[model samples]
Target: MAKTKAAAENESQLADPSVDRKALLSEALRRRIVSMEMAPGAVVDELALSEEFGLSRPPVRELMRQMAAEGYIELEANRAARVSSMNHQSLRNFFLAAPLIYIATTQLAAIHATHAEIDELKAIQQRFREAIEQNDVENRVLYNDQFHLQIGKMAHNPYLMPSLRRILIDHARLGKIFYRHPTTHDMEADLGKAAGQHDQIIDAIARHDAQAAGDIVRAHMDLSRRRMTEYVAPVGVEVPLAF
Candidate 1:
């Protein structure tokens, strides 16, 4: 009876249903785009999405519009929509805005992330390790985000959370696609190195070393930049397709 009660109690502490649902839609679309499941430059079939989620067109359209506004999609002249294909210029702009925001956010989190939150982060990291083991690309993306967003919320800064959310959304799109035809050296494109870095960042946070936490994040971002350099188009050039 005690074990049963504990299990039920633990489930109750999970994310609120509404917030979880919104995040579900948001993260799914982001991963789909990045992995090219939605394919850059391909139309997003709103009707199909509405049917898939068992949602009415109105709410689904609203969500798609929100994503599009965030530069995740391109609405064509004829009113059709598809994932945006970032050329070198746009990708450059995206990466440039990310580091400044993410580092500051994680720094705040290290200072404020409670002991309970730290434990929660460790559990999420465990799941991430499992995902990496199974080579579950899509599931790995979700948990990859589960960890960072948890830290962002721990920062206790409401305004910073939204910006960090936006940054991860963009990063998810880039990193997943970037991995599809990743650097020749990696060959398999396994993100083991990046996943390992997550453990390092968690350690820094657990130690409550704010400067170390921020530095780890910088290294994390730099590693992503290096991994992505292979696919980065020339400045001012736009590619019609990405892997």
Candidate 2:
């Protein structure tokens, strides 16, 4: 009789609507941030979020605090929280730091990844491929972020994981611009190459080839950098005007 009552109580809790509101809000905010729906440096309105989520200000503030800690937003004294910014200096730093962090984390992941983590990476890659095929710019950026983040998790290094997380937050925001403007003649082909690199990365990690994994990750970062640069300032022929 006690076991029956306990099971019923567990089901009741599972059926409760309010319990998941916090998680729902968190996930919605995360998606928005990652997808660039909340632009970089945009101010986060706590009252607006509270109304949108149908929650009180306290929970909304708590959620903002949590995201702030996770590198998704910046909180300042006497100011509303703002989405993490990607200014020129920040982009310069990101370019300088990305390859090093990715290489180190990927090397460690190759050394320490488990079979389950590799499997998860494969699943994420599949989704990434689907996003490309469907022209889902947001999901492509998001799944790519997840792909690298899973690699970071596999690394299992406390010191490196936080760096990896910070790097990825900015990386995703930048990647949105790349995905949004697919101007290349062979955009699909470029995506296919990226997916192929992902496969190679997974294989190298599974084989515990740290050197090869590092090389692959560097190449991956280079590809992303090249693509982002193209969008930043496309080359054009100068036209002379009559003086």
Candidate 3:
């Protein structure tokens, strides 16, 4: 009876909505990387984290390996794990390559998306716009990335997804810097500008205008890259003020 009870408990935990160890660890690592809480090139103290999380070193190391594969961390000297650092050249390459890849997927989605998939993208955009107005830019970036990701999902190209996800996320992480800058020329005054572009993309897709959708998606990324180039490092990159 005791063994059966324990088995039931384990099964219940496995079915529990909140029970997702891999997801929890992955999200924790992603937040730390994106918020710069883990400084670029700083070594991750694996032993310390395992103690803090009450897990064995193996699980923590597994998390580190996942982040390293994602380009958020790297193996440093003698197999020491460290967060990845920024390089302007790599950022530029990502900016250039990401849009082309995403645009191509958007074209495919526009060609093939069902009405339901189109509606789902529209819904993601709607919630995204609301998050922006609420000054929940954090949530906005998350959902905004989802909006583009949905496009790729509708593309139905298994081979394209891995690269699409990598590039889009690199831009999403840079969103931390982009959101902080004052709009150089009234861009913030029109918070709707980004939303409008999203709507245009959706409309093009719904109309099955693949070429036009691709063009607008490209233009949106172009404007973002231009604005990001204007982002100054907020004066010396001191420990972020957020507690």
Candidate 4:
């Protein structure tokens, strides 16, 4: 009887019109961090968040802790929370580990995804395509993140999902940079390939083709890495051979 009542209360809360304060704040902070509005290593102001959400410090701090655990923020014993840093080492690790993680997660998703999950993935792809059409950089990055996150969830592996989540935070941040600087690359062709690959990924998952799914994810990551590298180091001046 007690368990039933608790479940009912949970359902009622879900049905409520107002969003939970902590959820609201966490999402807002997540957007800021992922969009680079907060930038890597930016300090999170607990008091400011409390004021914005109309919540007290204790709850705000709890929200910070949650974000910290999710790799979106870093918390220390005596300091304010900071947005997770993307230093040289972190970026190196991201590039090294992202392909394996994405491939594994996608392969598992192909094996375990349900019809409902595939439907949801298709919906996210539609929004992702629309974001590209509209040139909405933030939403493009956001929807892309959601697309992979859904696949990660479908993987149903607790061990892999957490690492996938952490990897995606940096992935989204890097995507924001890539999208924001369209002049740096052939935006249309690149985005078109991405959109098409998204469809292929969905198709592979629907057909339960784990090997195909893994191949697509690896190719997708390679494209992303190439674009990001091009954006980071564009060809220009000649380097001195001697020295």
57 in model 3: Cα distance from truth in Å? 1.6
- Models sorted by TM-score, best on top: 4, 2, 3, 1
Clashing pairs in 3: none
Q: How well does model 3 score by local distance difference test?
A: 0.77
Task: For residues 68-122, write the lDDT of model 3, one tens digit per residue.
Answer: 7778788766877877776777687888788888799999998999999999998
lDDT digits (tens) for residues 62-157 of candidate 2: 888888988899999999899999888888899999999999999999999999999999999999989888888878998999999999999999
Q: Work out the TM-score per prediction.
A: 0.73, 0.87, 0.79, 0.87
Poorest stretch of ten by lDDT in candidate 3: 1-10
Q: Which ten residues in a row have the lowest lDDT in candidate 1?
A: 6-15
* Residue pairs that clash (backbone atoms under 3 angstroms), model 1: none
* lDDT per model vs. reference: 0.74, 0.86, 0.77, 0.88
Give lDDT: candidate 2, residue 120: 99
lDDT, candidate 4, equals: 0.88
Please identify model 4 stretches exceeding 4 Å from their true place.
Answer: 1-19, 238-243
- Whose lDDT is greatest here? 4
Pairs of residues at least 3 apart in sequence or in different chains that clash in candidate 2: none
Cand. 2 Cα-lDDT: 0.86
Pairs of colliding residues, candidate 4: none
- Provide the lDDT at 7 for model 3: 36
Per-candidate total of colliding backbone pairs: 0, 0, 0, 0
By summed lDDT, the worst window of 10 consecutive residues in model 2 runs over: 1-10
lDDT of 1 by residue, 19-119 (tens): 45445566666766755577667888888776645567888778888887766788767678888876677678768977887788789888988899989
Relative to the unseen true structure, what is the C-alpha lDDT of residue 221 in candidate 2, on a scale of 0 to 100? 89
